[model samples]
Target: MKNANLFVDEAEIEVHSGTGGNGVVRFRREKFVSSGGPNGGDGGRGGDVILVADTNIGTLLDFKSARTIKAPSGAHGGSSNRKGASGEHIEIRVPIGTLVFEVGDTADVVELEESTAIVDLVEDGQRVVVARGGEGGLGNARFKTSTRQAPDFAKPGKPGQSRQLRLSLKLMADVGLVGFPNAGKSTLLRRISAARPRVANYPFTTLVPSLGVVERDDRRIVVADIPGLIEGASDGAGLGHQFLRHVERTRVLIHLLDLEAMIVEGRDLLADYDAIRRELGRYRPELLTRREIVVLSKGDLIHDESVVADLEASLAAREITVRRISAAASLGLDTLLLETFDAVYDARQEEEKRASEEARHHERVGRPGKI
Candidate 1:
């Protein structure tokens, strides 16, 4: 398990555009005529190296094995004033949330050099040309003037450009399932969505994030079951950045608590919750302000209902209410989905409103009237 199916989200690669073909210089010689005119054709343009955003790709794993990508070269000129065929452009498919970084021109190795953010590919089918192809050269037929009717000179084709690039992927999810390991997040995801993540009663069962779609009444909400977090998660410990960066884009968070484990270990439930909250705040203070839903999971394993009630009362007193549920028993899951969907809708509405306001401000500033 240590070396199998690793999730790669960041990669550095080298790309080169296709080089143009050389022009041809030819003179036509007829069987009966004394002299024939020059009939050399132009060379074809080279191909471009393009990057496209694909919704299906979830990681940058393909770039790990293949680091260098080059386009096809163009065809050379013909004898009868015919233009050569252009090279085919190559498209590199990447994840939708991929961020492209362009390395400096003077840098030889992309890894050791500094790079700047060139594009944020967030939408499906979004495309950008990373390196442009070379221009084709002119043939001897174009140089046939009255002063130099029999000119035998042809321009050489220009060489294509090359670039060094880095790509980083950040998952975009509507709801993020967050908790310590063995908190029944994977179980709940299996019951709610079609994703089949590894399930066990141990720590770090889910090493990578798993995305699933929960659809109800033609409404679909994407949920990401993030990896477990430990004490020093904010400082890159125990799946640190893997957990934090995925949680950044989520509009709502489902925080799961394993009551069965807590009771068996004789640990305080609030202490566990408080520790995670502290880590979240430490990593990003704004994460504490996100819409979080507390859920006491593994309800079926708890034989006594009084333990849940007392814990709920204790949390309610502290202004937090836990949604008691068991994925095995199919308990209290529909309500959680509804609340999460509503929260996602509200978040999207707020974003749209903010965008509209900013657009209006720009429009007003561009106009002649000062308001």
Candidate 2:
């Protein structure tokens, strides 16, 4: 509960678009002529409900208390061929990586059913219309013909669309830092980026995921420090289920290990690593396949370099090379950042290549063939 603000990722709200304005029936009046023709104008269209993605906002905290969002209705048409004013659109700002789901059966008396995926707002300034406004009805003047002398009736405007929407936010980052509690992940994040996450010596100091932007060689890499994981994390132990989902979108993971804790607390380094891996595999098998960089933190606590070398050698046997770094002393940090950035850049290139190949394959498969 320390970082409660970061966990407000889900919200459900109802949105209603503006109704169209009604057209009025009027006749043009002249100063000299006794008879005048119909001059009534058409009504204006209604407003739309739109969702905008904003990078500044990190969570859906704003929508937690908001139950319903309504747009302003269009103004009614006036006499003498004066058109009605269009309704103002209602815009809602959400996090950049928000996923919008359209809820079905939103009646007050009935229970809501499963929601359908509408759209994913991933980039800044991206927007999507959730509900459309009702159309305006035609005026009586439009129905008037040469045979008809005067029309007295006018059409009303149609109602706007209304529906319930669910907004779910998933943090998007190039690197994700994962570890047990008090593994110096928060300290490392603060040392590398401008993010000021609350760091303490106790366990579970970071209850929520914290994001920071690291700049290297004129390039920016966003890193997310997820909360610690314990045994049985996949089964919701120690609120691990809430934190693990944030790591799914990361391109690379920095698996931090506490060298000091291994010695002081008498914890085995390999066991700690495997336990976290098991949880990740159980929660999502794909997470196990992600590229991970093992990091042994708190090098300042250990005086002898052999201790660090021994641990590195042990992990190397399992095909995992460990990077030794001390956040307090700022030792080996520059190398760690450079290596992490390189991994992220390489992963991005591979992803783009795969996507291009898939697109070409689809195009070839969908092309016309001779009979």
Candidate 3:
């Protein structure tokens, strides 16, 4: 039997807004009135199609089964100058970083910059109406004038049109943890943070990325656990390029090491680390150069700290600063958090500094230049 692939990385969908209600025409009559003026009721406005950012949603798979979205139509005009009922608004639930694009050749569409990872959708409810309903027509009463008494003509309600939009979800996180399968990456995350990612004694227990919030005093950080990568992950091997792209927005990376797995499998832990680096280089070279914290996990498995100490010595010999931690016993967890937070904060400050300098340079040159 073949393995069932349940991953949905990308999807396309269409959204539309509600239409406006139309106006109606009517006449007021009485026993003594010779020619009563036109009194037409206006039509109700059409429902609006709204899109909201939801942090709880992790995937666009919900939109996979439903391809098209629509809003309610405006109610027709009523008699005695009574306006028609407006259409109801339709709210769409989308992942926070979902980007929308107009589907057409040379179509100029709007782009929303996802600068903040933790979007407060509850407070503001960032909403955008994809399509707007047409305006309601004017009633005959609205057209009444001294010269146009008892006008027989009344305006008709306009119809709402449809548009094609493309939605794409981009995973947002403060830090991303990357490594090979069964490298104690999940164990480290579960130990340091409150994220309860599925942990097991086997490989590939995490098929999807998970996130956790780490808080220390008044400071809080979001840590992401990206799925494991294999030898040819860049070219689509073992859950491939799909999961790698999720780490693109992370501020830092934590690479976990399993000392025992390396010694028993006849594999060099450093070499395994290098293999992952090579894959990162192949898939995204920038990822290889990002701020990373190297850690040797399951340190308590060995009899003495010398086993980890020897690995650290070897890494230091290669100019790599390694941090060792035993996730099971919660050893070195606090130090790991302190170092990671400081590193991530420093990296962010440096990035901000560069951005400010670039902006200043652009101001001086009166045009944007390459950074």
lDDT on C-alpha atoms for all candidate structures: 0.83, 0.84, 0.75
Q: What TM-score does candidate 2 reach?
A: 0.91
lDDT of 3: 0.75
**Which candidate number maximizes lDDT?**
2
Clash pairs (backbone) in predicted model 2? none
**Over the stretch 81-182, how does candidate 2's per-residue lDDT look in tens digits?**
777888889999998778887766553322222233578888999999998887876776887998986887777877898998877777889999988889
Q: Which ranking of candidates, highest TM-score first?
A: 2, 1, 3
- Candidate 3 residues lying further than 4 Å off, grouped into runs, are 1-9, 105-124, 304-310, 348-371
Task: Write model 1 residue lDDT over 1-371, tens digit each, in one string.
Answer: 33324778788899999888667898787999777898888888889999999988877889999999998877778888887778789999998778888766644552321124688788899999998888778888889999888779887777988988888777788888988888889999999999888898788999888788899997888898888887788888887755677777788899998877777886677777888888888977888999999998888878877776777778988999778889989988898888888988899899999999988988988744532
Instruction: Return the top candidate by TM-score.
Output: 2
lDDT (10s digit) by residue, model 3, range 71-124: 887776776888888788788887665666656764443332334212323222
Which is superior by TM-score, 2 or 3?
Answer: 2
